[model samples]
Target: MTGPVPENGQHHDLVARLVAVLRATGGTAAVCTACHAVIPTVDGVGLTLFTTHARFVLGATGPLIEQIEDLQISLDQGPCLHAVHHRAPVLVDDLTPTDPRWPAFASHARRRGVAAMFAFPVLLDDHPVAVLDLCRTTAGPLSDTDRRQATVYAAAAAVLLRADADADHGDGAVVSASAARTQQATGMVMHQAGIDAAAALHRLRTHAFDQNQDLAQVVTDVLTRRLRFDPTPG
Candidate 1:
């Protein structure tokens, strides 16, 4: 929440390097690559872009990070999505099953070995455009320095995204096929359960977590009628 000026000697150097990377590569992938190289405290970093009609992961430092991003996308809840919605950082010092804020995300991320998570929203023109997510394998709060550096990295991501927009990169308009399917499945669940959109999505996410199945798989089953949102699930 506090903007630490990146002018300290080391942070200043990092900012320069990030700016160079953005100029050279000009996308979220480049931002992730730079973060992975410069920051060694966290297990991995991920970038998710949110546009008016779509949301997608632009890049990640590792496969697990990619999975985490996808999981959040599927469930429509997590630090990243929360950060975007609130337009502020979401920092979970330690992930626990008892955390009620994101019940499904916390349990699944713990199962996947994520013990701490931080999400910083990237804003452009005063609107959130993306989230920079950092996942740690150990449970603990990030050092103040690490938090500041992460904030700097998020700022750089915003710059790169703005550049991509100016160049008509079309990344913002890119919708994931999985996301489309999830939307359809949510609609079906709404109809079947006689619930509103929010309740239907929550029901779908709850079923996925209860079955220990991937949300994508759950959505597939729903679409194919293998799973139903009846009072007693079939």
Candidate 2:
């Protein structure tokens, strides 16, 4: 997903603003807020920090976006993973069910009403450590200007993360918190569907993909009693 500079022209002022904001604040939430101020085309912003032994959801603008990241974590696939693994941006201008790259992740995100997705890896000291992601509710790739600005934002995130690594509470704490919630939902699936843990999780992932809904969302419904599994696909 590479492109030429946008015809509308460069917004260097916005890039400066983002860098200043990231420097002013000590957290990703503040950085996201700053992004919303400068970038008008994006709907949500997310960050994921990866280490050799653990992976964590660094920060995000809201619950929807956090869940989007969680879905990828649960399934271990998607554009975000691709970007992290390849150390390049994964830009899906128009996300569609026909795409086979991320069978489960793509379908669920599509159901969540995400029309476009972009993920860029963040590096510090020449090693990749995090991903900066953007989700668009409207269908299309980010403008060249927006994409360039995203790279700027990603750089800021990488710096802040390394500067205060101790503040983050090591051991994948952020991701582990979300993972615990997922396990609760998984247990619900097992009980309602009368299956083992592995089977129940498989059922949840399959059901979400088949229905084009997010895995975390389906799990939420089950926990809330809004949905139930009958030991059979329906």
Candidate 3:
């Protein structure tokens, strides 16, 4: 895998395309479907978000990626798992008998005609929020240009994942009416508490606990203006 550093023009073009995908209606699913078309070397793409309990696929480009991501979760091996857990990129030029990192998973991938893989951990505040898996049918590592472009895509994915989590939605789909309220209320707390993102979420959960209320209900009350956080002494 060899190529010159990709020009800024090309990188800018890719970023713009990814932005368009993010703005479209389908959300993560739309981004997954459109990304492969933009990156010629990427034969497939899969996105998975890591929750405290498990890793769930947000979207996948096709059957190949879908199958691979599931296998990674079930078998507990492969590039996606390593990337997220390690908070680093995993690039295997070829999946073969000698690849010690994920021998079992590689065997399965080989049977599926997947010759290579690249996985990047999407990070926020130095923590991995998700993993983006890129697969290829050809046996080789990514070229320099491909790596740079992939990094840009991974960054875009991090932003989208945070947005989805904040909005109480999964990809493009609405999560729930209550969940949406939670999102709005969290924003209110963020404003009142003069805090950053995580602090605002913490306030929401703490307020729910202190009030002996469901998180959504507390959020709803706050959103509807029936309850307010005191920013000053009354």
Model-by-model lDDT, in order? 0.78, 0.72, 0.71
Comparing 2 and 3 on TM-score, the stronger one: 2
**Model 1 ranges with Cα > 4 A deviation:** 1-17, 172-234
Better of 1 and 2 by TM-score: 1
TM-score, cand. 3: 0.65
Question: Model 3: per-residue lDDT, tens digit, 96-163?
Answer: 95568888888878887899999989887889877888998888888886687778778777766677
Stretches > 4 Å off in candidate 2: 1-20, 166-234
Write model 1 residue lDDT over 30-77, tens digit each, in one string.
777677666788998888888765566677777678678878877688
Q: After superposition, how far is residue 58 of candidate 3 from its true place, in Å?
A: 1.4
- Residue runs of model 3 more than 4 Å from their true location after superposition: 1-17, 170-234
**Count of clashes in candidate 3:** 0
Error of 3 at 101 (Å): 1.1
Error of 2 at 140 (Å): 1.0
TM-score list, all predictions: 0.69, 0.66, 0.65
CA RMSD of all predictions? 6.2, 7.0, 11.9
Cα-lDDT of candidate 1: 0.78
Q: Could you say which candidate leads in TM-score?
A: 1
- Candidate that beats the other on lDDT, 2 or 3, i.e. the better one: 2
